[model samples]
Each structure stands twice: as structure tokens, then as C-alpha cells.
Target: MTPSLTEAVAQAWPPAEWRDVHLLAAVSGGADSVALLRALHKLKREAGGRGRLLVAHFDHGIRGVASADDARWVAELAEGLGLECRLGVAAGPPPASEQHARDARYRWLAETAGEVGARHIATGHTADDQTETILYRLLRGSGLAGLAGVPPHRPLTAACDVVRPLLEVTRAEVEQHLRALDQPYRTDATNAEPTYARNRMRNELLPALRLEFGEGVDAAIRRAGQQAGEAQQVVGELAARLAGEARIDGSPDEVRLSPALLAAAPPLVAREACKLAWRSAGWPEQSMGAEQWQRLYTLLCDAGTAGLQLPGGVDARWVDSIVVLRRTSAD
Candidate 1:
């Protein structure tokens, strides 16, 4: 049997240790987020905890009146729960795309968490979201890291982390919990607009897949993600060691690599090491695709290619047996 919302939250993230820590709940007035806020509030109250519970809502300003309504509704909900609420609005028009909107929301969340001194910025990412993310990345030809899917907890900032306490809960469970409480939530019409690739997948592709393959498809994909995550963890450990050995004395803006060392390691580990080096140097990876990583790997291992230019002004060249990567300009 599926666990209750509170049971799922407790099982996924026990609240005993975190009861006294300040939490910033990202409530968008949607069913999932509203359910999350309610569940956390219930858990905290039941634990008789002295922890501060805060609510954050970011309005993308995409839907005009509807967006404003969401913000107001969330504030009211927070007040009803006797929690402090912080509301943020986009400075200008809606972002150009869904990704841009997401970026803006997260930037705001991080800032909010910092200003409020919150330890955890909790979000309402459920199992459905994870499944969607896995499918999305798989369609994009993602590497093992991307295929591993969304993590339950990640750093929003050095001092604050993004947590999903309801990751194990399904959408159906969220709605059922709300129904039992006689609670209402705002719905975004954009979710059904069909213009966004995610919506299209959720509405058309995923349903068709489920119809064709049954519920077992979701289980299979989730299993693959679990296996991929385990594999990536091993790869990350090996790559960290490889990166340590391959990195030459360098400036923060520049990373020098020993091609001999990289060439000696397995291709997968070597490529991951190169990526780690790039990330450690704070180079731009938004534009770096699998093809670019492959090209960099080839340049590092093959003797034919002397040098290569990479995204975010990173210049890689072979100087003797060393591969030098330097950021020539700011991204």
C-alpha cells in the first residue's frame, strides 16, 4: 500500500533532527506544493518542534492576473498555517522559456533563503517530476550524470540546500491527501498548454507510453535511474581521484592537465576527470554538449589534434605533453 503523505515525508526525510531548523517551503499554490507545505506544517506541529516554518512564492508574471492571484492565495495559505511568507515577483516580463523561468525562480529562492537564514529550501518535486525529468534527459541523449535524474537534496547555496521531502510521494497521493483535508489548490492553465515539451510529454507522450507499456514502464525507468545513480557515484569517486592526479599546478582561471595520465586511465573516467577539472575552474558548461566533451576528450588523448576552443571562452591546447585549458574571457 502507498504510504500516507505524512508517512512518505517522514520515511523520505525524518523530521526529528530538522524540527528546529528554519525551513523555506517553496509553495506555488499548486496541488503538489500546497500539499507539501501542509504536510510539513503538520509534521512540525506534531513533533512539538520549535523550528521556524517559512513559505516562499515566486511569481513569473506569465499569466498576469492569475499569477498575482497565485501569490495572494499562497500568502493567505501561509497565514492560515501561521507561518511567515516571502513573495517575489519577476522584475520584467515573463522569461523567454520554461528554463529561464526556472533559473529565475531558483535564483530568487537562494536569495530568499540567504536573507531569511533558512537552512533548507524545500520544494514539491514528486516522483512524477522525477520520472518526467528522466524521460526528458533520456530524449536529449544525456550522459550518465543527467540520466541519473533529479537528486532528493542538492545545494542551493553553501549555507542552504534544496530538499524534496515528498520525492517518494506520487501526484495521486498528493491529491488524495488534499481531498481528505478538504483543501483547495490553484491550477496553472499553462500546464495543459501543450507548447512546452514537458507538457506535451506529460499530456501525450507519457500517457501513450503508459497505455502501451503499462505502469511497469515507470518502474523500469526509475530502476534505470537508480542503477545510473549508483554507477555515477562510482564514476564520480574515480574521476575525483583522476582529476586530482591529472591537474597540474594552475591558477583558478586556468587548468593544466597531463595528457599522459589521462590517456592511461579508462576513457569514461578520463572524460569525467576532464569535466571535473572544467567545473572546478568554474568554466561555462551550459553550452558544452556531449559532442564538445567528446572533442575535448579526443584532443586530450589523441596526438593529432594540437588545440581546441571550447564553450565559455575556454581555450585548450597541447603544450608538450600537457593539455592547458584557460578561460580567455568572461562568459
Candidate 2:
């Protein structure tokens, strides 16, 4: 037998000493989210006036009838549960790009929560999702930050906090709870498609791994992510301290960094120092890649009075005692 949704929530988020916090739950009329709603409702009641709950649904408008139907189902469910429901419609089809859609969805959620005076946004991300994320990042050779996977709580915006209460619950348990309660949910057809990397990993890679490695693959990956998260936090703090020590400030178009200080720091610290300089010079993070880093480092150390032009109309020049990074007007 599987644990009830309430039992799962209690295990994942212990109620003891939990303070009152305004929460906005994101529901997609899926089994996982519906189960989360039920569990949170029960927790709220048991807490005896601990916090307020709000339901938010987004219609991506991908499937003509199915999308609207999902929005309607979520709204009706929220109504029956006696929770305030906030509905939003995506102006058009969410971009084919997964990262773009994710960014847009979170932006919509953050905006809605802010408008409704909600302090936190709660998402229904299960342990399965966390495991998949960790595996994907590992396969992609992601840095320590990517290895951290999804955090339980983080600031979504300056005003709103994002919380994941179902991080420890498996999809099987969520489905069982919803089925036992006779609740219906909408399944997105696209989830079954193999074109997307995540879907391919979920449907193909994971099953093969499970068949060969046994059933503990997900748990092992999650543990690795937890350890990586801790290590990344420590590294980030050290990098920030080193950045402060090597501070060189200038206009957004022009950034200056001390060559001697950068050369003296560890390779990781040097890379982070250069990343900070690029960001301060108004260059986005993704714009700097391995080759670009190599060019910048070479210019800073070997070739004085020389500059390299980066993609995005940015230029890095070594002059006097500092390397200056500037964005060209054409960028």
C-alpha cells in the first residue's frame, strides 16, 4: 500500500515548528498537483490558522480543447475545495524551447503571487522529477550549481519565495492517493513524446538504468544532488569572498579586473572572477563559453595592449594593470 497524500506531505514537510506563511499553489489539473492540494488543505486545517492557501492555474493553450478543459477542471476543483483560484492564459503556444517555457511559467506565477499578496509559491515537484533533473544535469556535464538540482525553498523574486513541499514524495504515491480519492486529472500528450531530452531520459534512459541497476537509481541520484548542493554552497561563498578581494569597478560597458589577482587565484576562482566581471559589464552568463574564457585569460596574462571581441558585441582588452571588458554598441 502507498502512503496517503497527507502522510507524504508530513514526511516531506514536518509541521512541527512550521510558521504561518501565505502560499500560492501551482496546479495543472494533474494527479501530483491535486494530491498536493489535498495534503496542504489538510495540513492547514490541522495547524489551526497557520497560513492562507491560494490556487493558481496556467493554460499554456497548446492543445485546443484539452488546455481549456484542464483550466476548467482545476478551477472547479479549487472551488470545491473552498480555496481561492487564480487562472491565467498564455497569450500563445509556449515556445518549443523547454527553458523558455519554464522561464515564462515561473514569471507568470511570480507575477500572480505578487498581485494576490502571496508571500510564497508552492510547486508540486516530486522526487522522480528531482531525480530526472539530477541525471540530466550530470549527463550534460553541468557545473556544481546545476548538480544542486531543485532547492526546497528559494526566492522566486524580490518579494515572493518559491517552495517545493513534495520533494520527497514519489509519483506512484501521488497517483495512488488521487486514485483512492476518485479524483480525475488531465494528462498532457506532449509528455509522452520522445523528441524532448527530458522525455527521452524519463521514458528510455531511466527504465534501462532501472532494469540493469535495480530500483535504487533515483534515490542514489537524489543523494548525489543533495551532497552536490552542500558543496556548491561552500564554493559559492568562497568565490564571492575572492571576488570582493579582487574588486575592480567601472561602467556597465567597460569592466576592469586585476590580472595579478586573477592569476594568483585557483582556476575555479579565476573563472568565477571573470564571470563576475562579464556580468558586471552587462554580458549574460550564457554568452561566455570555454573558448571565450581561454581567449580572455590569454589576453589578460600574455598579450598586454590587446583585445578580443566576444560574441554579443563584447570586447575584452588588457591595458596597464587591469583587463577591461566592454560591450560594443552593436551588441
Candidate 3:
């Protein structure tokens, strides 16, 4: 007999004491989320736990009826499972884009979890989501950080940990678990719509690749992400060493690298040092395109005196003996 979802989750958290741990489950009333709730509840009961299980549902208010229905369904499911439920509506002015909406949702979730003193906030991100994220980042020319896809645990703050126990499971497995448990879930019609970038990747890009190339394209990309993640760790270490060697100051917001030191370092280390410098100056990750990176590389290698002002008021200047990166005061 195969291990139940509860067993799998328990195995993942084997070292966890499981007592008095407030687990906040982000439930959208979808099959995946519902399955996560059930599995967590089972684990809580089996451990003879003293902790509280809270369900948080956010209504993005995109679809009129469907959005409300999802929140209602999640509340009902939480009640049925004997878990406390909190419902939050995105009531302020709508965000500018879907990406913004998602960011707001996670921010709200993190804030709520902190308010409730929850130690762990669980999200239902399956292997399929991870695979899609990897492919999307790759297509956007993201380096190691993006290729790492989603991490299993992210420290939301000093207090809370954003955990994804379902990272190893696939969407189909979650649906199967829901079916086995006779759990009812709502499917968002918007997920099928190809307007979103992620939806386009899922529906159009991945399918085409699978049909044209072979099956397991998703797995292949995921494997690549794992390898890239490891390689990125190595590169990050080397970059840190180079930063130390080239440093005139330690403040992340303003970095000054010794041009002589940079010139002596390996090419990859030099490139990553520049990336680190830009990141320290508040530039968004992957904001620099390949051409931009190449141009910056050329500037770093050849020019004795050059400066490039980037978007977001960031500017990189190469003086006589040092490369300086700072955010411009101008808005």
C-alpha cells in the first residue's frame, strides 16, 4: 500500500516536534489546497498535537460570483475539518496587474500569519507549479536565483516560515487524494484562460514541447532548475569572496569594487560580482537583459572611465581604480 498524503507530510517534517505549532494553511478551496488541509489535519491528530490549525482564504475579487464562492467553500471546509478559518477580502484599490495581485495576496497572508502568531504558513504548490516556474524563469533569461524556482521554505520574517510541503507531489496526486476523500473543490475557470503568462506556458508552451520533443519536459526542466540552484550557490560563494576582495565599503546599498581586484578574478566571478552590486543597489533581479549584461561586462572589462545609469534610479560608475554602484537621488 502506498503512503497516504498525511504520512508523506509527516515524513517531511520528521524532526519537527509538532506540538504547539500553529500551522496556517492557505486554502483557495481548490483540490490541491483541500488535500493539503486534510493531510495536515491528519498529521496534527496523529501527533497528539497541542497546536492550532488555521485556514486562511483570500478573495481576489476578480470573478464576481466565483471568487465569493471560493471563499465560502473554504470556510465551510475549514469548519468541517474542525479548523479555525479567517477570510480576507482584497478591499483596497485593485492592483495594477495579476502579478501585483499575487504579491498583495502573499503579503496579506504573511501579515495575517504574523498577527495570529503562526509559526508555519503552508501553501499548496505542487511539482507542476515548480516546473512551470522553472520554465518561465528560463524563458525570461533568469540566472541561478530564478532557476532555483520556488524554495521549500522561506522565512517570511523573523517569526514565520512559509512552507510548501506539497512541492514533491504533482497536481494529479492532489486531485486523486481529494477524490479518495470525497472532497469537493472548485476549479477556477481563469486558470484555463491563456491570457496570463503562466497559463500560456502551461497550456501552450509545455504541451508543444512535450508533443514535439518528448514527454517529461516538465521533469527535465525541474531537474535543470535543481542543478542550476546548486551551481548558483557555488557562484554566490565565489561572488561573496570577490566582493570581499574588491570591497571599499560593506554597505549593500552602495558598493565600491577595486577594479584591479575584479580584473584579477575569474570571468564568472566578475560577472556575478556586478550582479551582486546591482542587487545591492535595489535593482530587481533579472531586470538586466542579456544585451544589458553583455554591455555591462564590456564596460567592466575595457573602460577606464564609464558609467551607465539604469532604470529604477540605479547607476554604475567605473572610476580610475574602483567601480562604484549607487542609487541615484533623483526620482
Single out the weakest 10-residue window by summed lDDT for candidate 3: 187-196
Q: Give candidate 2's root-mean-square deviation (CA, Å).
A: 2.9
Residue 329 Cα positional deviation in candidate 1, in Å, after optimal superposition: 6.9
- Cα error, residue 259 of model 3, in Å, equals 1.8
Whole-model alpha-carbon lDDT for candidate 1? 0.86
Question: Residues 224-315, candidate 3, lDDT per residue (tens digit)?
Answer: 89898888889889988886677687456676777777777777777787777667656675457666766666666665646887655667
- Which residue pairs in candidate 2 have backbone atoms (N, alpha carbon, C) closer than 3 angstroms, thus clashing? none
Q: How many residue pairs clash in each candidate?
A: 0, 0, 0
Poorly placed runs, candidate 3 (over 4 Å): 15-19, 189-195, 250-254, 281-288, 303-318, 326-331
State each model's CA lDDT, in order: 0.86, 0.77, 0.77
The alpha-carbon lDDT assigned to residue 175 of candidate 3 equals 82
Rank ordering of all candidates by TM-score, starting from the highest: 1, 2, 3
- List residue ranges in candidate 2 displaced over 4 A: 1-8, 11-19, 93-96, 180-182, 188-195, 298-306
Candidate 1 lDDT over 208-310, as tens digits, reads 9999999777767877987999899998899999999999998878999999999998888998899899998877788988788889999988767967889
